[model samples]
Target: MPPRNAARLYPLVLLLLAFVAFPLYWMASTSLKPQTEVFRVPPTFVPETWTLRHYVELFWLTDFGLLFVNSLKVCLVSTGLALVVGSLGAYALARFRVRGKEAYGRLVLLAYMFPGALLVIPLLLLFRQLGLTNSHLGLSLAYLTFAVPFVMWVMRDFFASVPVDLEEAALIDGASRLGALWDVVLPQAVPGLIATGIFAFLFAWNEYLFALILISDESLRTLPPGMMRFVSTTDTNWGLIMAASTLATLPMALAFGLIQRYLVTGLGAGGVKG
Candidate 1:
């Protein structure tokens, strides 16, 4: 149940919700609108004649399916790589007696903060030299330059929030260090891992500049750059753009819906000390 004061916050909360959700609702509505109706003066709040023409064109006329597949491939691989490597790095930082661990943690955050613009030229040069340009694996690794550090930073706090006593107790029971981590520590970290993983996934899913610069081939493009195909030098396809955008939003929306129960608590704990 909401606290007494929360009742008074309802108006503000609803206002915020409308502020965020209206664009999404409008986008969906526009995607279903007939092209002629989309440009009508004053516009309709809801479509007069709903149709799937845009969505159909998105697949058959454009290679949105290929773009979607490319995005999914790189993102999933990069996210998995970041999670495994970052979790181990965070575990070491939080649990081991390493010197300057705090400084190292700060450095990770610093790397994450470096503007993508700064790395674009250097990474493009490096990947081209390494012949990683135009490859999904290269793109995935490029994503990692940011994704790994973010995962490490968040997971570090999460690992720190978990009580060391529990790991010690397992050790006292004769579990190996790795075994204790597997049996005890990881179970407690599930929510945090899932929350962090989702955040990392979002990063890769939406990143545009790197994908644009690194991959010159049309077939290799991810959604953000792929969306640009809808806009021509003379005209734009609003319906197809909106339809593609609306469809792109589904995976993230579904992911959040599935795990929102744990998201807040996990984030909160990761930000706090035990």
Candidate 2:
């Protein structure tokens, strides 16, 4: 609290920021470097010859544009689905007094206990039987197997933190239960929702296993798996890889930036029971 202590902390904070920011700075700098500069024995800290050739190539030469679209679509849809379904499930767990409620709650989380590698084969067979393989909707559903459980787990606490009297008041005002949730409760839980949505989005955006296994169609491959096309047995394009990685981070950055204030509040509230 003292001025001297605050001054000591500022340097530590800036040092921490620089440590965190270095990778981003390197990725961006490397992506902008020309091929000649990227592999130079003594690598330049900044690009000697700054260029957008990698990005230009990314859009014009490869299937990157489509991959970007596929990732965006799948992550968005999956996040929305997770939020809706998980919120309802969490609400039920929070509000309902039913037999096996604790068991069911644990079961929801048990889905996440196994590694995706263990489940991919059975999932493949199921997808084949249902003709869900290689479809965005199918992948969206696949993502929910993970995201929904997490959402339910986190949101249970958040929903529990919401006052039941608020919902009772809404009921007296002639609002349906869902109406009360939407009109009264969700507003108070915005921070949690936003935080949960971010986690769901990151899961879908960065997930590779299901995207690779469930989607055989080249056009349908999400970014993580799709970007591997840039690698070959003989060669790897560092610039191309860095460029893709840099671009891949944008949607998440924008999402966080837009909801920066909500993130800390939501994560704190949603993570802890009142």
Candidate with the greatest TM-score versus the true structure: 1
Every model's Cα RMSD, please? 1.6, 1.6
Model 2 Cα lDDT, one tens digit per residue, 37-147: 999988899788999999999999998999999999999999999999999999999888989987888788898889999988888899889998889999999999899
Pick the lDDT winner.
Answer: 2
Clash totals for all candidate models: 0, 0
lDDT of candidate 1 over 1-274, digit per residue (tens): 6688889899999999999999999999999999999999999998999899999999999999999999999999999998998888989999999889889888888886689999989998999899999999999999988988888888888988888999999999999998988898888998888888898899999999999999889999999999998999999889999999999999999999989978887888788862
Candidate 1: stretches off by over 4 Å: 1-3
lDDT of each: 0.91, 0.92
